[model samples]
Target: MWQQKKANRRMSGGAMNSGKWKEDELIQQMLRIAVPIALQFFMLACVSATDAVMLGFVDQTALSSVSLAGQIQFVLNLFVSGIAIGCGIMIAQYWGKNDPKSIEQLMPVALYANVLFGGVFTLLALLLPEQLMRIFAKDAALISGGAAYLRAVALSYLFCGISQVYLTLLKNTERVLLSSKISSVAVVLNILLNAILIFGFLGFPAMGITGAAIATVFARAVELIWAYLAVKQERTGI
Candidate 1:
């Protein structure tokens, strides 16, 4: 009986060890999933910081223009993020159920919703930029400069609509690292283009705040294209 009890204790110890190993593995997997998502958002925040810092070198008015103009994007992001989060929850559920076809069907719905929201904001920004700027600032320079920024960046709203949905899908589908890479590459390009186009480096014309807006537009466009390519490669199609 004592021998049998000793063997049982040994088995219990082994079980504990196995459980501990699994716990460690679970933690590692969670980190693998979380770190890239965190990094993507970090890089995204850096874009705005880069713009503020770089434009500050030009003048206070330029600095203020980009800063205030960014508010429009910020508000739109709230709506986009809400949609993306809802879609992520649904996709994760579908993935858990092993329902790929349902996910495929859902993708187009989310994409259209995002694009629709983005289009509305694009039109508003394009057609009523000065009025939109006035909602944030009363100064004439701010209204005029930020209006230019808004109009130039209006197209990016549509592009981001597409990219952000894909990115959220990527996260849900366990491809968060790729999502991070796409955002990071686009951010780097944006920062580089901001410097080049703002000051006309490498023979590029100095476009001031307009250059900053264009940089964002170009970066969002690249991000959308990259996400689309990733979707194609991964077969995450609608």
Candidate 2:
């Protein structure tokens, strides 16, 4: 009976060891996915933080104007995010079944939808910026400032919409680290350029609120470029 007891103890120990190993592996996998995604969100938040901080130094009016203008961007992101989330869900399901062809079919549809939405917003901002600003604020100074920002940032909508789709696809395909890195780099560059342009650092003219809008546009362009290159390299295996 003592020998049988000893055998059972050994069997239980082996089972526990196997279970622990699996738990460790699961934790590692979760961290691998979670950390990059968390970083990506942090970087995106930093873009707005950078804008608010730098614009604050310019003046209260500039700060308030940009903040109000940013609301439009916030609403646009909500729409884009909804589309991206839908794409991610479909892609995840298809990927589980090893259906790359289906993924290919779904992506262009999402892209078209995103671009269409982006174009509509861009036109509204570019052509009727004051009207849009009036929806958010009544002060004439705020409207004037926000209209300038909207015009400067209008082109970014198109670039940002396209890039967002690509980044979502990258994340779904397990290129989370690459997506995070691209966004981080672009945000950092934007902060740097914001300082340089907004304050006339390095002898650049102090472009003020216009400079802030330009920085965002430039950063979105950088993200789109880097995402394109990364996707191209992945496809070519180079």
Candidate 3:
């Protein structure tokens, strides 16, 4: 009986190892999963560069406004990203346990929590954008423009929160490639829309500070749609 149990254990281990034996295949899979993610993050970072370039071309005020607004958004993002990391930990542990239902159950609570926290944060940004700007000791043009820009893009926390949570869910589910694709699509949409809206190209209204807000909202929407589609396709199923 002892020998039989040992043989069973060895066979089980061999079966597991056999399925994972193709080192090249594993490497390819890792690259497929990792490259897109790296690219997506790079793309997101590029958006900031793009924003600075385009706004600077418009005028110094446009550049300053967007830059200041970005500062407030950045601080809020730190908190939201922290929450996302915690959610990731929860999702990863549950996923390892093969509990999709738990993931589904936990996601809404996490999302709603982000929403609640983000909403309050947005309120503070809206109500006291100028005060926050003054704290930065920016020049007059930047302080006023930044205040205006923050007011215009005040919903940033909500938009970012929604996008961040969904992406985190995908990551924990091991759908990193798909998540990256979604992010890439959103970045493209954002850049295109920014050009059109900011420049009034094709007769679109040149919204200026408001244009940046619109682009952000549109990009988040695209990201959310792609994430939902991925979830519907069961790509994240273990």
lDDT, candidates in the order shown: 0.92, 0.89, 0.81
**How many clashing pairs per prediction, in order?**
0, 0, 0
- TM-score for candidate 1: 0.98
- For residues 1-238, write the lDDT of model 2, one tens digit per residue: 9999999999999999999999999999889878998988898888788889989999999999999999999999998999989998888788778887888888889889999989999999999999999999999999999999999999888888888888887888878888888888988998898998999999899999999888889999999988878877776111
- Residue pairs clashing in model 2 are none
For residues 189-235, write the lDDT of model 3, one tens digit per residue. Answer: 88888888877888998877678777877788778767777776884
Q: Which candidate is the best by lDDT?
A: 1
Ten contiguous residues minimizing lDDT sum, candidate 1: 229-238
TM-score of each: 0.98, 0.93, 0.82
lDDT of 1 by residue, 95-214 (tens): 889898999999999999999999999999999999999999999989999999999999999999889999888889888888889999999999999999888999999998999999
Q: Residue 45 in candidate 1 has what lDDT?
A: 89
Model 2 misplacement above 4 A: 1-5, 236-238
Which pairs clash (backbone N, Cα, C closer than 3 Å) in model 3? none
Report the number of backbone clashes for model 3: 0
Candidate 2: clashing residue pairs, number: 0
